[model samples]
Target: MDIENMRAFITVAEHQSISHAAKELHQLQSNMTAKIKKIESEFNKELFYRKPRGMELNEEGKKLYAQFKKIVLLWEETRSMMNEDSPVLRLGLMVSKNPPNFDDAMKALYETYENLMVTIKTGSTPKIEEELVNGTIDIGFLVGKTDMNSLHYKKYGTEKLVLVGKNIDKPLEEILKHDNLIISSENCYYKKILDVLLEDHKAIRSDFVEIAALESMMNMCQLGMGVTLIPESDTARLGIRHYKVIDHSCCEIEKFISYRKNHKITGVEQQLMNRIVTAN
Candidate 1:
């Protein structure tokens, strides 16, 4: 089967209209329709349901679409590798209070491959994992654990959690009792650890505030609006004053580097991974 035909099929499946796909691909609508028909004739299967609304993929088309996406990705990667002129790396990073030395790794990669193009996407661990599984990203750096069997993970390191507030002279219990606890989100990993710490100290806050941005969180903490639990490294970098290190084992969370299990790691990827591991 022609790669171009497969690409056309994928495009039509995505857009649900040959005309729209043709416009996006810069091809004539008739040419796009012919390509789709050619694919259907070759497979001897009706891949789409053509209604007045648009063309929708049937079950057979859905299955083939998934496989074709992987094939196209592999083909592109192989072609780039063969060229030996330029390579692209897509990275998915989870939001972290204390991130890994990914900058150093990226710098090393750039030095080694002058023409390398790097793309980065930042999100939650689940989002990163989803992108990795869908082949949208080449690698991911995330906190917490993953149960995805389609990907492989390696322990990068651990981040120490710390409690930061404006007033450190007061007792831990008094601080918790008087101030609100600021958190990035309800699902934040730090919130979970804070809950555990509260239970251990038998402390309860008057209220809690949710702020999404890290800089905003820091500013809130600085203003004495509330106390928050964050990575120790972040506290130092942000020049946060009055923070107590949480010594409990649970305070240190393991970080991991994740990638698709079947992904072909090129020399560039391997070099980047090596630098990251070594730095950690």
Candidate 2:
């Protein structure tokens, strides 16, 4: 079936006026009328009964309209979703509070391929991970290790997790008595570490406050909103001093590029992934 002709029929059916449909579609009145006739001739059926005030669906028209409406809507939705899957590769990045080296990796990936659309979404681990799992994002650079079986990851490197706060803080024990720990949402990997700390120390869950991203959390911490646990790289960038955990339980974590393992990799997506891995 001619999708365009059906589209015109559907619109005319909806508006009940060829003139109205033409106006809405930015088409000429005669053009709209001709398209409707084209559909009718093809089906050997007249879809609409013309009247002075407007048009109404005939019996044959009503049945065909019901069937075609579902098909057209589905086609439109499919097209819309496919629009997100343009031949251009889509990439999602989860940059820490610090400068990310993944930009270099992207530059490397695009150097050899003209068909690439790199989209960077910078946020805390939880936000980025959600995008990767939901398939909203094609690729992601996340902080910390993940156990998701469907997704595979290659740990590029580790960034030291430092204790960040304003002035003082000779040792962690002196501060652990405090009531709050500012961190990312629960979905975040780093936040998981904090949860462990809170559990071990018997810290109140009510004292935890999750921020949107590293920058916001760090800024809030800087303004004395609350103390935050962040990567050592963030400490320098936020212009704040940091200290190491005294207990020797390592706070450093591995960063990784993660994607669905079972997903059928398109040729272009595969090539792009290869380029990303090679560049990294």
lDDT of each: 0.77, 0.65
TM-score of 1: 0.63
User: After superposition, which runs of candidate 2 have C-alpha atoms over 4 Å from their true positions?
Assistant: 1-87, 95-99, 108-115, 122-127, 168-170, 245-247, 264-280
TM-scores for the candidates: 0.63, 0.55
Among all windows of 10 consecutive residues in model 1, the one with the lowest summed lDDT is 93-102
Question: Please, what are the lDDT tens digits per residue for candidate 1 over residues 1-280?
Answer: 9988988998788778898788656699999999999989999999999989889999999998878866765565455567657677888876644245677667756765678988888777777898999989998877775569988776668888778877756776777667788887776667777777778889865366888798888888888777888777776678875787756887888888788878876656655664565466
Note the clash tally of each candidate: 0, 0
Per-residue lDDT of 7-26 in model 2, one digit per residue for the tens? 68876876688987786556
RMSD of 1: 14.8
